[model samples]
Target: MYMVLVRTRVLPGDLLHDSYTGIAPPNTYKLGNKLFSLKVGLVEIDGKDVKLIPLAGPYIPRVNDFVIGKIIDFDAFSWDVDINSIYTAHLPAQDVFGREFSSQTHSLTSQFKVGDMLAAKIIAFDRTKDPVLTVREHGLGKIVHGEPIKLSPSKIPRLIGKKGSMAKIIETKTKTKLIIGQNGIIVVQGPSEGIVLAARAIHLIEEKAHMPSLTNMINELLTKEV
Candidate 1:
């Protein structure tokens, strides 16, 4: 049986020890007679067996997830993107940033080339094709660039919070527009100092995503001066 040495405090990549078996999960292993498990994840280490914790900002893109990406290439039917996620998100030609594609040429690379950033949402992921993304709605499109920072994709949902509570708080406090990508990237614009402070605050929230009262904590932190 798995021994519960420390209740549930294990961090991602933490090794769990079995009392009788003396072995642990392959990704995780135990040291002989050691009371505590080693922290193998990027951030912290915990000895107890706990829920799987994402080590970084959002990485995987679920359907309907809002994301920010850079346009790598544009075609008459679609736009190739470099979203921070594991897959290359695609923007259909019909969903082009502004209007339906008027270009007769199949290749739209001339119109939109590399390094064009946009705020979009994941609509669907077709295993045959790439993940389909869109920026065809209001509140979506090129984010006004200011200071760019990278974050883990996994931590995004937490930073956003339920009904966008966490994000709203940060936006209100920092007075900056924060755009998050599924691939661990974020775009922040507004006052330079405020953006930096907001980035730090978001990182903190990502680290504590599993906490129950994180919103309250972040609200307090954002309210305080940088």
Candidate 2:
């Protein structure tokens, strides 16, 4: 007699009596508006995965997502970068920024040089093959100035936080602009003092993403006036 709401994407015991219709003979029900099937065998909810049910969420890159990369090797069109996964990503000179060129056209080596980093977005992929990337936009480019800090690439989710609340808060409080790379590099810029505060806030968020009171904790830290 377990019933799940048709539109709530409830896994068991999620209080679905209102969002659904009809009774259950232990029957699998259709997911309705704003809901999706949580077909995964079982998942942790509130710290424990006791029941198998439906949930609502979106797919994000995990373990290894094949990514396109840019060459930093001056002479070669290919270079390597981590793609938030176990496998390293390669971006060949031709594919480094992704555009076929005439041999007479400018060589990629001239376009991208050593010490240059590229910002790219994931396009498509085949795990067996290298992932494709593109940087054909204003925000994507080789970082020219700013101090960089390295962090655990996996911790990006916590750094970005739900709905980007964490990042927004830091930017607002410190008045600094930040660029977070999927590859674990972060760039912060502002007045000398503000940049320092931004860096500390980012590091703190990475260290405390799991804490239940993250927002309040960060607010208190940022208000300390250095």
Candidate with maximal lDDT: 1
C-alpha RMSD of candidate 1: 6.5
Off by over 4 Å in 2: 1-43, 46-71, 74-85, 92-100
Per-residue lDDT over 1-226 for candidate 1, one digit per residue giving the tens place of the 0 to 100 score: 4433322455543444434234443234446644233433322324443323444332656788777788887655778888876678878766663464565744566445678777888889755657888777788876656666776666676777889888888888889987766566778888887898898887787667667788888877877775
TM-score, one value per model: 0.65, 0.62
Clashes of 2: 4
**Whole-model lDDT per candidate:** 0.67, 0.55
Pairs in clash, predicted candidate 2: 6-32, 38-54, 77-92, 77-93
TM-score of 2: 0.62
Instruction: Tell me, by TM-score, which candidate is best.
Output: 1
lDDT of 1: 0.67
Give the count of colliding residue pairs in each prediction.
14, 4
